[model samples]
Target: MGFAERFPRWTSAVLAIIQLALTAVIIGLEIKSIFIDLAHGTIWVGFWASLIFIKTLVMMLFITCCCRGRCCATYVLAWNIFSGILACVTIYFDRTFINDPCKCYLGDKLCCAVRSVDSFRTNYTSILDQCGQAIANNDKTALQWCSTGSPPYDKVQYLKAQLGCAVGMLISCALYVVIYIFACLGICFGHD
Candidate 1:
């Protein structure tokens, strides 16, 4: 095949691979966040959505590699559209959820942060004194786990990584859309 004929297939394959890798990174981050109790509802949503998107990308890659002619153009276009929407939603969810103000715990026993001090007090009375003392003294190490203004250091890093990967996924999706548009046009003009 000529360069023009093979360009779309190569681009589609490369974009799908990149997106799959980014989605896997997001899933890994979500799983780690769950262990630290940093995974919010939106994180869970993003996790599930990433899983679905991974499957979709795999299928699209297979179709793009194996299918010839214009028969699969409509299917690929539809998948690309869905992937673009999913990536956008993931970006929004990650941005809003991570930036929201919430307490993050960094103690030996408590690694999760809650929104309400009263709720935290009621839930973990055993560590209340320690947390209170740390808060009162403003001990940097101890306060790291008891502060209420922002997320813990680890959680912040995790959120940043997830957000970065989400943005990468969005970029890949956009590239896929562009490549598919050219592919569709090629087919319409009997170039494929």
Candidate 2:
């Protein structure tokens, strides 16, 4: 017997669980990004994240249902196709969104503005000092998580999270591809 014949139930459960975990991580990262964006008065970033988060939540439900019953083969195939398309679109848009420079400031004083050619999106923020003054712009000032000895709130962390989400999405796409292939095979062979 082939892999599918030996352990069909086990395979379905494992794939569902893995996809669920990846989606959960994607959700957590997006939530963090939302909080960060809200703190900075940026709406679009959080809005996109919210959309993706909701979609992932729906995917989680489908996967859960798939794990519980035999009525899920067709649904799973459709969900996988939708997820793959969404993931591709998300990755493309994320690349476009993060390609701008972020202007970091504390009030009217420009604390630090990223160089105009950074490879990430704009995450304009204001980090105030204890005196309610903005930190001076310097080579060490970073917006996300930075190794440049910059203050907290470096935009690098946000960019990294976006990349992580894209990776998870790609993995999910691959999983769905495998699932749909088997689903088609089952249908053609009259196994279902």
Candidate 3:
């Protein structure tokens, strides 16, 4: 059986849709930062936007891989593994440390200011108090983790390089071409 026979064409279409949808959900996670954290400064806004765009492009890469099939399937798997690790790091930091703020995946991977409070969206009094503590106290421990180099936070960047980021990016670029070719020529190339 060929690639399509090994996996039904419908499977690819379904997976592409599912992956794209999940990517949207991941992007939504950043919305909290956009409204609440990014507004705190233009610097933060620029940072987060860049990370968001990067993630969006990665999703687009995965979708293209599904559509073309076989080629770069290994690379797609590796890309996803790296992505999952980052997601885990995000969850760990969000739950445990105040300094290890949730990193934006797509656009900039920039740090969103972390106040020692809970709810991201709301007029909670705790948020202001946390901000006051962050500002007035000049907590060095908090500051240390606040940098992207801190625990859990540094893991995402570390994995990307080890995975041969340049080769992965090249695969992404190839997938983009495959997508464009099909868009213009209609599966003629993808089939054989």
| Stretches of candidate 3 exceeding 4 Å from the true structure | 38-69, 97-192
Please tell me which model should have the higher lDDT, number 1 or number 3: 1
Mark the regions of model 2 whose C-alpha exceeds 4 Å error after superposition: 1-7, 39-71, 101-153, 186-192
Clashes of each: 1, 9, 12
Please tell me which predicted candidate would have the highest lDDT against the true structure.
1
User: For model 3, how does the per-residue alpha-carbon lDDT over 94-173 read when each residue is reduced to its tens digit?
Assistant: 33323333433322211323432234555445545654565567654443333433333333332232223323333434
TM-score sort, best first: 1, 2, 3
Candidate number achieving the greatest TM-score relative to the actual structure: 1
Model 2 weakest lDDT span, ten residues long: 111-120
Model 1 lDDT tens row, 1-192: 433374456776777788788888888887765544542323464577786678768866876578744546556657767876777777776676577524333343343333233445466554566667766776667644434434534555666678788778767777766776676666567664
**What's the TM for model 2?**
0.51
| CA displacement after TM-score superposition, residue 90 of candidate 1 (Å) | 1.3
Output the better candidate (1/2) by TM-score: 1
Q: Rate the local accuracy (lDDT) of all candidates.
A: 0.62, 0.47, 0.40
